[model samples]
Target: MTPQPGSYPGLTRRTLLVSAVAAAGTAFAGNGSATAAPALALRSGSNTLNADFAWARKRALDWVQTGKPGTIPSYWAGLTNRPAFYSRDVAHQMLGAHLLGLDAENISMLKVFATSATERRRWYPLWAFQFDGGIYRTDYKSDDNFVREVPAVFELTEKGVRQYLWTGNRAYVDDAALWKYYTNSVTYFIGAHDDNRNGVADEDGTGKIFQGVASYNENGEGLLEAGDGIASQYQALLAYSIAQQARGDEAGAQASARKAANLRAHFEKNWWSASANRYIRGFTKAGARTNFGKENSWFLPMKGLTAPGPRTDAYLDFVHKSVSDLPPFNIEAYTYLPETFFRWGRVDQAWKWFRYVADSRAAYPEVSYTTIGNIAEGLLGIEPNAPASALSTVPQLPSAVPWLELDHVPLGAHDLAVRHDGNKTSALTHHAGPRPLAWTAQFAGRYESVLVNGQRQPAKVSVVEGRTLSSVTITVAPGAKATAAV
Candidate 1:
């Protein structure tokens, strides 16, 4: 289905893509030469403190230049000359690229995985992508690997659709080849890997889920099954359901959604560990629980698989307590922890973790890239729903942070600059693109009134996952600014 014109606000595909690609070319001209893009002018400070946003921005841009040309161009997992693309790493990297408005780089990475599906098998490569002329190699061995590398393909499909959502690129959504690849990949994943037929894919019974090297924590041992794999499957199924619905396949979409819901129910039943007050990491083949204290258990709340309440509260508490024990610069755990904390209303903890990582300036792409994302999408809460021509801003600015400003945030066709002062006052200046923009400002506490552009607008109050959230939506023309006060 072709989206109607003006369906997604802000930038056009040609404008965004051309400019992004041009910037990339200028930054990385010549054969595989790397240069960092200039840091974005994102500033945050208070009376007693200030943050160096430029450092994080420069590091993130530097990481993207590590992209190497191959069957499809993708950012390397690290600076090492391994010349391989790990699916999970690529997935998170692409997400960071999208948030940074690096449209060309993000699309290139997505295309690599999108086109790298095993020929005729309809599944993504196991974990790594080995480059050869135009051919890509999957790191699958019958004896050493038993669990199907489901997350890679799942993430590719999921993130592919998300790219369309963020860019409003109809041509990509309507591509017949990509649709076939994505649908077939999802079908194969369900048919081949979901051995239990319980909607969640099971390990090959060889060992822990990570035993097959299918997770971000590849070196860990034990029966580390179910936690990340199961949660990721649930997410993949939901994403597929959305993709199916978008493509006009009602039956397919419904089936996927039902399966996803079933998977979530199964996980909640089996994975919750009452004794530990958190989800068990995974189970051994002998039915014994393992890694009860591992951070993967926290992924449940991060993925929104857990319902909000006392149980969810306990889960977040578990994570909060565990943070002190976490090794410094643990990118895998940090990726979603900050966002999860902010969503759960632990704003100070979230800020603390974010600050810790920002201070480290870890050279890992996931570390630097996702940290930037946490600040923009998590702390600032600038969520762009390009499909709807509306974006949501739910700043969880910490109490100590008196002011924060993010400039030139690309939202589909528009560039948005947001400044928040005091605890509840925010000014959004929209540098209009080709279309009008609609915004929803969501505040954390109950408010007596909500003002948009100095006028009181009707505010909607709702409880989400046990937290009170208040929101107001306003439509603005090109070159207009809107101030929201709660």
Candidate 2:
């Protein structure tokens, strides 16, 4: 079983006290600038479910703050020791922040990092930043001295695409600095770091993090390329492709897509180990593969780079069997598990880890925010493309949650509600928006047809990430509701 926050005997109360003081001073008592309290709510038939959801939801909402008058919109995404946000943490917590109606904060913070990468720093963004937009000194002494990791660069680029998908924000494509960042992250950054010329970014292979490291696993050293780094690069290429398509750059989109395709193909051909029947985690400077597990093993599937089949299933099984052993003590690392399982359509395993992290009661800011993100993106499976005014959902509710409803979810121009009644039925309502919403209500498994508001519609069957989905698209006008059943 995963350990709870209380397991660390000396720190829980003190951490909570500090977090409360921080929240009260900035987020709750801003110069009348903080956004209104998040109206989002999660409810279920079970009392335990309600209680758990409320605990995480409230804690996450408390972290929202209008920082120190001059800072960009901010939320707690790092340790409580300082008023700063870490790149890895912020990128991971983005969905939860967006769900809380912090789109401006997301835009501000992401842009800051997006613009901070420079040629002098080899195109790596600083690892963490103070709320006031200064580089966090503790992590930076000079341009060459900061906590830089390979996965963070690509993760931020990929997450920027996530923001565009959720909000349909044109600035993601139109903004000069952000557009440059997206292009640089995949092209220039990789060019700067690929020592072996393998078309993937690599750290210097000294294994020292301050100089450069390839993976989020800081302690794993001497790695030229880590699984998480390469996997994230692949996704970043895809994200850039999506952003280019949104910008009407067909040639640019196809070029990025081809790069992404080649990267996936390369990973499929090279990373798998037939004897071990699992993906090797990383490579050393000497051209040797290492299966260090943890981030190296799980990040491949989590980033959607794995080809779905027996090999992918076996790796997920390996992850499930060894999850509790994932290290560095803090529960924040385990937060990645829920999304990893969801990527492969393993709902039971997804819920298991979701509950594990949600129930851990960890005080680290990433935990609470990620708990909410998992509810929407993992268990509920929401995919939004606001530019197109479209939304899609796949229900992954476990048996424990007979019915689940999330209300006041912010998506682009609208506030919406989504409900799942087990795996058989799902519903969405457009609460507030100028135009009607194109809702694609999706469910697991194959079906001959589906019922939309009890009217039969031809069910479209398709494979996505190796899972079969039966879906029907409908227009949900403002203040109207639509339901679909398989």
**Candidate 2: residue 198 Cα off by (Å):** 1.3
What is the clash count of model 2?
Answer: 1
Q: Please write out the lDDT profile of model 2 over residues 1-486, one tens digit for every residue.
A: 111111011122123223222322222111111135338888776676687678877888787765558777888789878778889999998888888777778878888898889999999998898888888898888998888999999999988877776776767666899999999999999999997788989987888878989988877567888999998998788778777776667687668777877888888888887776778788886664645457877898888777767878888888787775655455877889899888677988998888888778787888888888888877787876665566788888888899899998877667789999998989998887757887888888899799999999999887666677788889999999999998
Evaluate all candidate structures by whole-model CA lDDT and list the values in order. Answer: 0.59, 0.78
For candidate 1, lDDT tens digit of each residue in 1-486?
111111111222222223333333222121110112222457677532344366656666665543454344445554344555566776766656755656665555555556655544435444555543232334444424423354456666666665655555543455665676667666775566565566555445443432442344443443435566666666666666656655566687667767667776777788777776656666655663534334456656765667668888877777777776766545555666676676566788788877766666667666777776776776676655554455667767887776888877665566678777765877787775555676778788887679887789778886665677788878867788988988
Off by over 4 Å in 2: 1-38, 325-328
Q: How far off is residue 359 in model 2, in Å?
A: 0.9
Local distance difference test, candidate 1: 0.59
TM-score of 2: 0.91
**Candidate number of the best lDDT:** 2
Highest TM-score, which number? 2
